[model samples]
Target: MPKVKRALAVEDLTKIAMYSDPQIAPNEDTYAFVSATVNDDNEYQSQLFLQKINGGEPKQWTFTNAKNSHPRFSPDGKKLVFQSTRSGLSQLWIVPTNGGEAQQLTFFKNGAVNPEWSKDGKYLVFTASLKENDDVGNQHEQTKEERQKEKEQQAKEPIVIDRLKHKSDAHGFHDDKRAQLVLYDVEKATFTQLTVNDTDHGFEDISPDGNLILFSANLDDDADYALTNDLFMLNLATKDVTKLTDGNGSYGNARFSPSGDKIACFGHEYAYSGATLNELYVFDVATKERTCLSSKVDMQLGDVMVGDSRMGYSTEGPVWSLAEDKLFFIGSDHGTTGLYQADLKGNIEVLYKDNNHVFGFSYNGVDNTFILGISTPTNPCNFYQWKNTELTQLTNANAELLEEVSLSEPETITITAEDGSEIQGWLLHPYDFKEDKKYPFVLEIHGGPHAMYGQTFFHELQLLAAKGYVVLYTNPRGSHGYGQEFVNACRENYGNGDYTDLMSAVDYALENYDFIDNDRLGVTGGSYGGFMTNWIVGHTNRFKAAVTQRSICNWLSFYGVSDIGYFFTEWELGKNLLDDPAKLWDFSPLKYAENVETPLLIVHGEQDLRCPIEQGEQLFITLKHLKKEVAFVRFPGANHELSRSGNPEMRIARLNHICGWFEKYL
Candidate 1:
C-alpha cells in the first residue's frame, strides 16, 4: 500500500529549508551556497554548503547555529569568506575550501559584513559601521559587561531625530554611526580605512589591478532628502576619490570587466518615480561615458519576484563574461524572472527561463557553467548546475520533508481588464481538492505594489490552501513583471485602476472555475494590498471577511509616521502632505470606513515603521466607533517583515490567526 500524505501544517515552516547565494569556485568544479532552516527554538539558522558540479550530496561547511551567508571564494579557490552572527553580532569568518576549522577575521565593535576577495587574493574589502568621531584604527571588541552598560545608557538617553529618514524597518532608529569601507591585508593582518564620510558608503567591487576600490554613496549636502546613489572610485595609494556617474541618477552593484577597461551596473533615472524599471548600463573607464545597453529591453533587471520562503541577499548581477564582450543578468517579464544576456550594442538573448523562480546564481564565465538557486511552488529551494544547455540537480535540501506533505500546484491565468489590458495571476486549488465539492475562496494581494507574485514557494499561501480554501493571487496594475506603462498606471490613481483590476481577476475566476463558492469569499493583503483590502471592504460587501496587515489607512498620518511616507506619498500618489493634504485624505481608505459591513481583522506589527501601527489603530478605532464587526491583532516587537522573516513562533501564530479567522467567518 502507498503511504498516506499529510496536509502542510503551520509548523512545517520550520521543516522547510531555504537556499540562496550561490558562488562558484575559480576552478569551476565546486560551488558554495547557503541553506537556512528554522530551529526548534523558533530561530533561523543559515549555514554554508558545498557541492561539486558533477553530482553528490552537499557537504556542510559551517556548524554554527547562526546566519552564515554572502559566501565569496578566494581567487585560487582554496578559501571562502562569509558573514556570520556566531560571535553574538555579525562578523566575517574565513574557512578553508577543503577542510579545517573556520577562523574569525574581524573583531570590530560595530560588526563587519559583506566581505569580498580581491582578484589577487592579497586583500579583503568589507563594510563596517563607525561613529563620526570614531577612528577605524581604534575599533575594539566590547565585552559582555561593557555591552550591557552601553545598552543601559542608551535606554536612559533620549532619541533625538533631525533627519527626514530617521528610522528604518530593519535597524530601528538612527545613530551616530555610518557604514564605511575597510580594507584588510590578509597576510599582514592589518586594517586600513579606505573612505571616511558622514554618509554611508556601499562597497561594490575591487578593480582587477587592486589600485582602486569602487563604491556608491551620495555625498551631497541634501543627501538626507535625495534618493540617489552615485558611483565613486577611490585610489588606494593617493586616497583620491573620483565620481563616475552623474549625480542626477541612482546606480549600484557595479563590477569591473575582466580587462578592467569597462564597468557594468544596473541603474535608471527616476522617470516613473519609484516604479521605474531598472536598466542595464556599461561605463567606459577611459572617458567615463555611460551607455545604456538594455534600453531596448522592456523588462526590469534583477529578481523582483515576491515570496515568503526566499531568505537572504543574493547577487542578481550584470556579470561580465571572460571576453568582456557580453554581460549576463536576471530580468523580470510576464511574471517570470529569467536569466538574459546583453551586449555593448543593446542586443539581448534569453539564457535560462521557465515557470520557476531563479532567485540567485553564480556564473563561471570561463567554462560558461552556472550554479543557480531555484525555487518553485512545491519546493522551498534547491541548487542546480547548468552547463551545455543541461541542468543537473546539486542539492535537494527539503526532499525528505516535502515527500511527506501535500502541496498545491498553481495554475497560471490571465485576466482581461476593462481597458483592454491583460493582468497576470495564479490560482491554487486546495491540497485535498475534490472536483465535485464547492470550496471557500481567498484572494491574496502582495505588497510593494511594485513587486511581482511569481513561481516561488510561499508558506502562508500553502497553509491556507491546505486548510481547504482555494487561493488566488495576482499581479494587477502597479505591479512589476509587466511593462513600464502597466507598472506606472496605478501610480497617481491607486484605487481607480488597480482596484478594478483585482475585482476583474476575481470575476474572471468565478466565471472560469466552477468549484469556487462566491458566497464564502475572503480577502487579505499587506502594505499596498492591505490598503486595497480596506478599500474593498469599505466600497463593497462582496467579501464575507477581510484581513488587512501592515497596511496604510490614512495618508495624512502615514506621511509623517512612515519612514518613506514623506517622499513616497508624492512619488506614488503625486501629492505630498504639505502640497495637497485634501487629495491625500481623499485617497485614504479610512475615508470610506462607514461603508464597511463585512467582518474585518486588522493585523499589524507594533514596531513597523513602514506603515506604522498608528495607521491600523486609527482604522480600528474608527470602525469600533461606528459599531462595525472588526478585530485587531498586534504583534509586539515585530517589524514590516514579520510575515517573511519574523520570529518563528510569531510567524506560526500569525498563520493560525489568519487561517482561524477565515475558518470562523467563511
Candidate 2:
C-alpha cells in the first residue's frame, strides 16, 4: 500500500520543458531541435540544441535569451536557419551549424517566419507581413510626421489608446493583414518581394530544382466564407502561378518529388470530420493526373517527405523516411503509435513498436541509419538514433530533472462498451496504492475528440495522480489512432455512443480496480471533453463533482460564437443552425440543465475564440439561476491553449482550480 504524491508546485514545473517538433539535419550526422526549458522565474523559453550521432554531449546552440524555435539546416548543412524574437520581434536568424555568432537576416517592421533554404542554397524563401503603405521614401517622411503628430496629440489627450488586441498570454494578436512570400538572395544580400496583393499566400515547399514554389492560398474565394484552401505552384522564372489542386476542400503541405516530376500532398475535401481524414495524393507534373497514394490505405496522412529515389509519409502525421522506393512511416493502427515501413505498392511492415508517441523521424540514405524523437509517460523528449538495428540515445533533454521526481507509469487497460466494442484507456494509480482502501478517481477526457491520449508525459495528469486520485482516461469513439470509422462514430452522435464508451471506462475502473471509490467519483476535460463533461453531469448524478474547461454547453450558440463555428458545426453536427435548430438544441448539454445535480466548476479563458467564454457563461448563469451547486472560473488574457501552452502562472492556476474544485465537492 502506498500514498499518493502531492500536487506539483510551481517550482517543480520549472525543471524542464515538454518538447516536441524535432527536425534532423540533412547529413544525418547531427540533429537540431527546439528544447523548452523553464527558467528560475517559471517562464518557459525555447532554445535550439544540437546533438551529434557519435555519442557526444548535446550542446545548446542559441543563447539569445528569447524564445528561438524551428531550427533547420541549409542545403549544404553548413548553416542553421531559425526563427527567434530576441530583437523584440520574431525574425529570421542564421547561425553556422557547428556553432558561431548568429546573424539576423530580415528586419521588417512586421516579422518573418518558416525559413526554408533553396536546394542550391542561393535563395531563402519565407513568409512575412508586407503592408499596403510600405514604401521606403514615403514611409520615412510619414514616420517623421507621425512621430511629431503623436507627441502633440498625446499632450492634448492624456489617454493614449491602444488599438491592438491587448493582454494576450502568448504571442499577442495583430491586425487582419495578409502575409506574402519574400525571397532573400544569399549572394546578392538583397530582398525581393515575390507575391503581393490582397490575397494571402503561405509558403509550403520549394522544388529541388528551385524553379517552382508550392504554396496554399485563398485567392479568388470569399473573404469571409470558410472555403477550402487550395495548393498552387509558382514558377520562379516567369512568376507564373498555376492552380495544382482545386476543389471544395482544403489542401496544404505540398512537396515536390526528388525528380521534380510529381507532387505529393495531404488534405481533406471539406472542413469537417471528413477533413480530419487526411489522404495523401500525388500529381504527375507532366500528365496532370492525380493519384491517391493513401486511397487504399485507411490512415490519416501526417507528413510526407520526398527523396530523390522514393517518398515516405506518416499515417498518424508525424514524420517518415522514404528512401529507395521504401516508405517508412509511423502508424497508430495497432492501438498504439509505432513506426512502420511500406513500399509504393502499399506493402506495409512494422519497423519499430513502442507504447509511447513518436514525434519525429529522419532517415539518412548515405549511412542507412534512422533517427527518431521518442517520448513516453515516464520520459520527456529525447533523440534516439538507429544504427545497425540498435537504438541509442543521442540527446537527454530532461534526464537529470526527471530522475529527481517520482513519476508513475500508466497501466494500459481495455474496456468493453455497451455495443461490445473494445475501448482503450490508461490508468494511473496513486503513487502508493492500498488495495483495501478506497481512493478518489478522476476521469479525464482529451479534446479534438479527434486527438488521442497516448503514453506521453502529461503534466496535468501527473499532478492529478499525485494528489491521491486514481486517474483514468481513454480514447472514446471519435478519437484518432484508431480507424477512420472509429473516429467518426461521434460525428453527429455527440452524446450517444461516445458517452457510453466514456462511462464504460469508468465502470471498468471501478469494477477491476478495487481501490477506486465509486461514491467519490469526479470528471473533467477541455474542448470536446468539456462538452462531454457538461453532458455527463446533465444526464446522471453518479459523480460527486465535475470540472469542465474550455467547453461548449450549447451547440446552437457555438455555431455563431466560435472562430470555426460556422463550418465545423455544419460538418460535425451534419447541418447548420438554420437547417435544424431543434437538433442543435437537442444535443446541447445546457438544454438539459434542469437535470444537473452534481456540483460542477466551469473554467474558461476570456479570450478563447474557439470555445468562447460565452459558452461557459451561459452554463454558469443557467445553473446559478436554477439554484444548483456550480462555480465559474474565468482566466483573463488567455486563449483556448491555456492548459497546454499557456502562460506558466496561468497554467498552474488552472490546474489548482481543477484540484480545488474536485477536492471541495468530492
Candidate 3:
C-alpha cells in the first residue's frame, strides 16, 4: 500500500488568511473585499479586490505593500474609503471606486478607524485617540516654568505604574490614551473634533439625516465595568449630548430609522455573576420607551439597523437590504449560526440555513439584491449572494491555494452521555478512507465552554484529518446554540459533566465509525477546551496522546491572572477564589495531575491575557515533576486569540507543533 504523503507538513500550512472584510458597493452591483496573500517572505500582505455578483474575474484594486481593511463605499458610489497602515500608522484613505491613486485624509499622530460617509457625501466621521497632558512628547515641550513645577512634584514621591496587559482584548496593546470621535470635511480637506473627553466612545452610527450621531460610552463612571456601556446621542448642530439608555447594562451600536423617529441597538443585560447575553432593543425617540425586539430569539443580535425604512437586525455587524426595507442578520442557537431576516414588527424569517457560518452581508437598496459571506466546517469563507432563492458563489478567495490540499467533510453524529443526555458532534474521517480498516482518531474540544464548535471551518481539524486521523469534535453541554439552560448546564459543574459528554462523544465515534482505531485515540482543545484536555488526561488514559492550547490548569491562579478572572471564576465555578479557595482548587485540573499518563503537548501564546502563559507553565511544570511525557510550545507576541486571529505565521507554527506531537506519539 502506498504511504499517505505525510499530509502536508505543518510548515506547509498556508500562512495567510484566506479572506478579510467583504464590502458591497453602494449600488450593490459589485463588491470589494480584502484578501491577505502570503508573499515570498512568508508575510501575509493584504490587498483589495473587486468582483461582480453575476460572476467575473476579480479585479485587484490596491497595489500597496501595507495592510488595508474595513472598506466602505461613499453614498454616491464614486469613492472608496478604507483604513490602511501604509503611512506607518493606521489612517483613513480615499480612492475612486473605479480605482485610482488613494488620498490620505487624516494626518494625526494617532490612528483612525470605522470611517462612515455623511448622507450628503461631503464629510466623513471616524474615531481617533489624542495624547494627554502627561505624555512624554507633551511634557518635553512644556515651558520652563511648567517644567520646574513638574520636577518638584516628581521629587515628592516615586511614580508607581500598575497594569496587567498594556493592551486590551478588543484593540490589542498600544500607548495608553483615550479614543474620541472626529469628523473630516471631504471638500475642504479639514478636520473637526466631534467629541472631547477622557473616556472611550465607540460603536458609532450617524443618523440617516446626518443631524444626530449615536454611540455608546461610560463617561464619568466605572469604565472597566462591562455593564456600564450606555447609548448616547450627540446633536451635531448644537453639540448637545443626551443619554438614550440608562441603568446597569450595555447598549451599543445605535442606529436611527430613516425618519429618525426610532433607534435600533443591541443591549446586553449583565447578570449578577457578570455573564452577559446580548439582545436586540428598539427605542422610540418620541416616546422614550424601549421595547425588547429579540427577547424571544434567546441569542445575541448583531449589526442591527433600519433597512429600507424597515427595522432590520444582525449580530455584531449589519446586513441592510438593497431597498432598505429588509434587514438580514446572523443568529446562533445550539451552536449553529444562520442568516435570518426581520421586519419592524419583530417578525423574522430564515433566509438561509447551513451547518456553516454566515456573516458580512451587504444590501443593494436600488436593486433589492444582497451579497453575503459564508463558510462551512470544510470550507473557507467565500462570497455568496441570494437570488431567487439560489445562492451563487462570487469569489473563490482560496480555491487555487487550497486546490492541491485534500480536505475532509465532517459527518454529523449524536451521542448519549452517561446520564442519558443527548449531545451533538462531528466526525471527520481520514482523507483516504478504506473499508474494514481502522484509523487513529483525535477528539477535539472547543473553548468558551460557552462557545460551540459548529459547522464552521477549523484549520487545525483539517490538518489532523489529512494525517490519517479521524477527528471528532462536539458541542457539549454549556455550548451555545442550545437553549440558555443547556448553555449554563456546566456552570459550577465544570470538569465533571462536560467531561462525561466529551468521553461519550469519543465512544460514539469509535462504535459507530468502524474506521476509528480505539487504542490510538488522542484528544485536544484550547481555552476551556484546554481545561478539558487537562481534565481528561487526569481522569482517564484511553488516549495515547493529547494537546492542550491556552488551557487553565489552576483555577486559583486564573481567578487573579485573567482580565475577566474575578467575574468569570465566580460565574463558572459559582464562587471566586477568595470566596472559596478550596472549591476553586477542587475543580482545578492541577489537582488531578497525578493521574495523567497520556503524552501531552501544551501550546500557549506568550501574551495571552485570557488564560495567560502561567496556566500552561503550571501544567507543563506539574507533568514534568510527575515524570509524565509532556512538551511545551509557546508562540511569541500572541494573545489568547493566537489560534483564531493571531499572526498567520504564528498560527501555522502552532498547528505544526500539534501535528508533530501527535504524529510522533499517537
Candidate 4:
C-alpha cells in the first residue's frame, strides 16, 4: 500500500523554521548558527544554536526568543559574542563556550550589531546608529518618562525631509543619521568612539596584528549626490585614519589576509552601471596598489540567487587561505551558486560545484572543514559540513514540519532566447497532475531583474502547484547567474528583449507540454519583476490575470520618491528623467495603462521605501479610473521585504492574497 502525503498548505509557512548565519569555531570543531520560527505571539523569534562537527543533537544556546544573530568565536574559542534584543533593544552579549549564564556587554541606547572580534580577543568592534550632527553621544541620557514625552511630541509635530537619502528600506523614518563604529574593551569594560565623521563608518575586519581596523565610508564633500565608498583603516593606537582605494568605484567586504600583507575585497567600478557584476580585488595595504583578480571571470563574485524564505540568504564571505596565497569565495554561475578559489596572480577555479544554490558559507582551515548553507527545489536552506570532500548535514530544522506536507521537485528547463542567449528556468507540475487533463499555468518572475530563480524551495510555488497550476519561472535576460553581458542585456532595452525572453518561455512550455491551457495563463512578480508584470499585461493581453507587488509604475516619480531612485533610475534605465523625459515616459507602465485588459491585483507594503507605496497606488488608481478590473492590497508597517522576512502574519496574508487573486481570475 502506498501512503499519501498531504499537499503543502499556505498556513504551513509559519510552521517551518528558517536556518542561516552559521559561524564556525576558531578550531573548526564546533559551530554556531541562527534559527528563526514563528512563535505564539505571531512575531518571528530567532535563537542561537550550537552544533558539533562529529554529530549530535543541535543545542539551543540563546533562549531570548527575540532576534539573536552574528555568533562569533573569540580568538581562544572560549567564549561566543552575539547581538540580542532581549532587553528591548539589540545589544552585545557573551556566553561561555562551555555553558554559563549569558552576560550583557553593551547598553547603548541606539543598540549595537555586527560584533567583530579582534585577533587577540581583547577588543570587540561593532556599529550603531548615530545622529548626523554628532554633538551628543547616541546613549539615551534621558529617563523613561522624558523619552515618552519626546516621542509623543514628535508624533504631533510636522514631518520634515532634508537629506537626499534620509530613509532606507531596511531602516524606517530615522533622523538623517549614519552608522558609526565603536570599540568595546572586553576586559576593561569600557567604550570608545572610533570615528566622528558626518558620513557612515562601517566596520569590515580587523588587521591580523590587531593594531588597525578596516572600514568603508564615503567621505566625499558631496556624498549625498554621489555614490562612492572608499576603503579606509583607523589606527587604534595613534587614532589616525588613512584611505586605501581611489574613488574610482565603490569597494566593500574588505578582509585582511592571513599574513596581513594584502586585503582581498569584492567590488568594481560602475563600468556597466548598476548591472555590473561585482569583481574581486587584492590590495597591498603597505604599497596601496590594487589588482582586480576576477577580471577574466565574468560571473558575479557572491550569490544573488533569489528564493522565497522567511530568513533571507546570499553568498557574501571572502575567506583567505592558510598561506594567504589563494582566496575562497562564492560565485553565481549557470543558475547555481558554488564555491570558487582565486589566487593573487589573477587565477580562479571552482572548488565545489553542484545544481543546488549556495546561500551562506564559512571555512575553517584548522580542521580543513567547510560549512555550507544551501537550498534545493525540495530542500530548504540548511547547514552542511564538508571535510576531506565528504559532506554531512548539520541541522534539519524543517525536517519535522516538511514530513507532513508534500512538495513538488522542479524540473530544470533551458531554452534559447531571441538573441541566441541561453535562458534557464524551472517547471513544477501540479501535485496531483494527470497527463490527460489540462491545467492552468502561472509564470513567476523574480525581483532584482538582476536576481536568478534557481534550484531553491519556494513555498508560494508549491501552493500554486497544489492548487493544480503548472508553475513556470525563468532566468531572463537581466538575471544574474548568467554571465556579466547577459545580466546587463535588459538594462536600457527593458520591454524589448527581456519581454521577448519571458514570452518565449511561455511559447516553449505550450509547445513542449501538452497539459497546459494557453487561454488560462497568469503572471506575478515583485520589484523589477512587478514592473515587468505590469509591462507584460500592457504590451499583450495573453495573461488572464497579473499581480504586481512593490512595483514601479512611472520613472519620473520613481526618480524622486524611491530611496535610491535618482541614481537607480539612471543606472537601470541608462538615463535620468531630466535627461530624457520622453523615453522615461515611454517605458513607464503608467503610460500604457489604457492597453491593459487583464485583471490585476496590486500588492505593496505601506512603508516600502525602495518602490514607495505611491507606485502601487498610482497604478491601481489609474486602472480603476479607466473602469478596468483591478484591486489593491496594502500591508501596513511592512516594507519591501514583506514577502521575504517581514512579519509572519503579513507574509501569510500576502501569500493568501496572491493565491486568492489567481483563483478569482484564472
Give candidate 4 regions above 4 Å deviation.
132-149, 174-176, 310-315
Give the TM-score comparing model 2 with the true structure, all chains together.
0.90
Task: Show the colliding residue pairs in model 4.
Answer: none
The per-residue C-alpha lDDT of model 1 at residue 206 equals 88
Off by over 4 Å in 2: 1-11, 133-176, 271-275, 303-324
What digit string (tens of lDDT, one per residue) describes model 3 on residues 160-199?
4454333455455444577778878888777777777666
lDDT of 2 at 578: 97
RMSD of each: 1.0, 5.4, 5.8, 1.8
Summarize candidate 2's per-residue lDDT along 1-666 as a digit string, tens digits. Answer: 454334444345556555545666887677776777666676667788777778688777877678798777888899989889887667899998765799988776667888888988999998887776553112121244555776587568544434322222233333445678888899987777777766578887888799999889877646446466788888999999888777577877676766677776667775344526776666787776876656666665452211111111212332224443544556555345566665556565667767776656766666767777766777766778877768888776676666556677999999899999889998998766677888998999888777778776677787778778899989888887666778788888889999999999998998998888889999999999999999999999999999999999999999877877777787778878999999999999999999999999999999898898999999999999999999999999889888866677887788889989888877
* Predicted candidate 1 versus true structure: per-residue lDDT over 439-539, tens digit per residue: 99999999989999989899888889999999999999999988899889999898899999999999999999999999999999999999999999988
lDDT of each: 0.91, 0.75, 0.74, 0.86
For candidate 4, what is the TM-score?
0.97
Q: Lowest-scoring 10 consecutive residues by lDDT in candidate 1? A: 132-141
Q: Residue 72's C-alpha lDDT in candidate 4?
A: 89
Tens digit per residue, CA lDDT, model 4, 1-666: 656778888888888777888788886778888888889999988889888878888899988668888898999999999988887778889989988998888777667889989999999999977775543233653455765888899899976977786778988665756788988888887778888888888788999899989999999888878787899989989998889977878898889998788998988888888888898988898898988898778798887878777373323667898888888888888788888888888899987778887778888887666898888878777889877777788877688767777788888898788888779899999987899999999999999888888877788888899888999999999998878889899888888899999999999999999999988999999999999999999999999999998999998899999988989988989889799999999889999999999999999999999999999999999999999999999999999999888888998899899999999988
- What TM-score goes with each of the models? 0.99, 0.90, 0.90, 0.97
> How many clashes in each structure?
0, 4, 16, 0
